[model samples]
Target: MIDFNKEVDRLGTYCTQWDYVEDRFGKKNLLPFTISDMDLEYPDEVAQVLQQRLDHRVLGYSRWKHDDFRNSIKNWYSKRFNCNIDSEWIYYSPSVMYSISKLIEIFSKDGDGVLLNTPAYNAFYDVLRTNNRKVIKSPLKNENGHYSIDFEDFKEKCKESKLFILCNPHNPTGRVWTEEELIKMINICKEYDVKIISDDIHMDIVYGSRMTPILKVAEDYLDSIYICTSPSKSFNIPALTGSYVIIPEAKTRDRFENIVRYRDFVNSPAILSVLATMTCYNDCEYWIEELLNHLENNLKYTISYLEEYLPQLKLKMPQGCYFAWIDFSELNIPGEQFQKMLIDIGEVAIMNGHVYGEECEFYLRLNVACSRDKLIDGLDRLKKTIDYIKL
Candidate 1:
């Protein structure tokens, strides 16, 4: 009986989610529903393994590849996604963002168009802009809270873009890309000669359905895809900063590896991160199952709560990630204004949707990866703020 109900005091551990809220917003005691990191404690099994490794105290420079590391990754994908991953395809990275940035630099050039669906993970925009690549938005249609990609528009955009970063189990929106949808994307990218960098960090967080890896579809089109994934998001060990990139083609993999080497970004991962990752993939299935159950219940509660009390707020329940993509347009307030109201009156921190891309100004993305009591508290504050506005 793991205690998902126990509220961990995360205030003083230099936590960005909790400790930095005051600095970022000039508000103390703000209920943060903003960052994607879960509020739940990490699995004890992983922690125990990490501690055991730390006790050895050899902390010297280490290597990324080992039989155990590769086997753990292979087994995880096999057991979870039913996807056969050739161990030869796996290459280590410090993080998913690092891999994406490196791949962006390798595959595309300054001013080359990087296609992204609007209301994407906001960090992708930062990565593109910082690298001097042009961001091409192929906006996802928000048809009354359900989000779907427009294939025609997507294809048109792909014609001009060099790379497409697909977020399966998309962040903020939480729409898990179906196999049919993924195949459609692959076909379009194929026709346009556009390469794909799939950020699958959230691959293991699906609620009821299994995650579909783009690599599974990219077998025939191996040269056109790069799959980036990490256990950080799945196992709550992001601070450990360990992730891997999967490149199916030997030439492409060599090219990527060469870039990593030339750029001096190659180094052994933190020993603890590797150990924790191996422990997680090999030993944490029960913990993940429990977490999925808890998150699904939270999703259901959020939907029912919105309907019962705040009908003006439309929620498209996420199929995978813990984020709830909520439409607050019925309140007739701008995204900034709504965010201001939430911060000032409600004192709740949520990511405003507009930052994801243009034309998402009426939406707010709430991180529901916390305990029920905290969730309800945030909801009550939201309700109170809405009621006050109505008055």
Candidate 2:
């Protein structure tokens, strides 16, 4: 068993979460529970594979269109999700966002409506705005901390949208889209003839539920659905910089490949990234199981701690991912001042939720994918912030 409680120092490593807290929070040495990446170390097997590759001492261009790379992904889907993935459907990209950005550019003109749920992954907003696509927001209905889709609002927005981006096992809120949810969404997009891009990057880190891939439910609507996913979040290797998109339509796949190869000139995956993917998917299943258990324990601790001390702060145990979305609206604190206090008085660097969407201004996203000691310390700091506000 992996000792997840063992703390590994990440300071001075140029780490975004640890080393650069001041950039976003305007305070150095604040305890940070921001950033999606984990503070925990990646699976040892990934490091082993990378080291073995480096020992060969020949870092050359590497193609990802081979049996080993494709089969690893195919086998992972089959074994983990009981879903069959065709070898032809898998295509490599540098990152999930890159694939999404390119797909938006390819399918939609500038100013065309691109629909997504509000309080989304902030980077989605960045990508859409950078490409000059109009963001069509469908606000999720949150009832007593449980979030659900407003299908009526979603369908109405679909009519105006050229593309719909789905975040399966969604970030921040951590709602694992059920198979029923996926089918409903797929049918809506199909009815409107809107292209779908499902970002299932958090598939492997689920709790108490199975992650239904968009392709699983959109089998009939395969031509319009694209799945952009990677092992980066599950394995905590974003720095390696590799991700992929699963496109079922032949013509669309060819067009995307053209842009990736000739237009963008990004033909090969990073040697270390592909090796890490293969190693993690093929040999690190045990590590993932342990990681999930650790995260679940952390979630339980967070829920209990909040209920005991900071009961006014509302939170629901996430269905998946390692983030706890806590509602601070009950405290009646203005979003901007509350954020400032968290930094100045509490000396904690939790993410300001307004950045995700205007509706999220009263919320804060806390990262729980750390050692229990760090989690306890972060929670104490959060409690300190709340106590100070009450004074």
**Which candidate's TM-score is highest?**
2
Worst 10 residues of 1 by lDDT: 259-268
Query: TM-scores across all candidates?
Result: 0.97, 0.99
Model 2 stretches astray by more than 4 angstroms = none
- What is the lDDT, from 0 to 100, of the residue 94 in candidate 2? 96
Candidate 1, which segments miss by more than 4 Å at Cα?
none
Residue-level lDDT tens digits of model 1 in 103-210: 898888999999998789989999999999999999898777788999999999998999999998888788899988999999999988999999998999998889
lDDT of each: 0.88, 0.92
Alpha-carbon deviation at 343 in model 2, angstroms: 0.7
Question: Candidate 2 has what TM-score?
Answer: 0.99
Candidate 2, overall lDDT? 0.92
Best by lDDT: 2
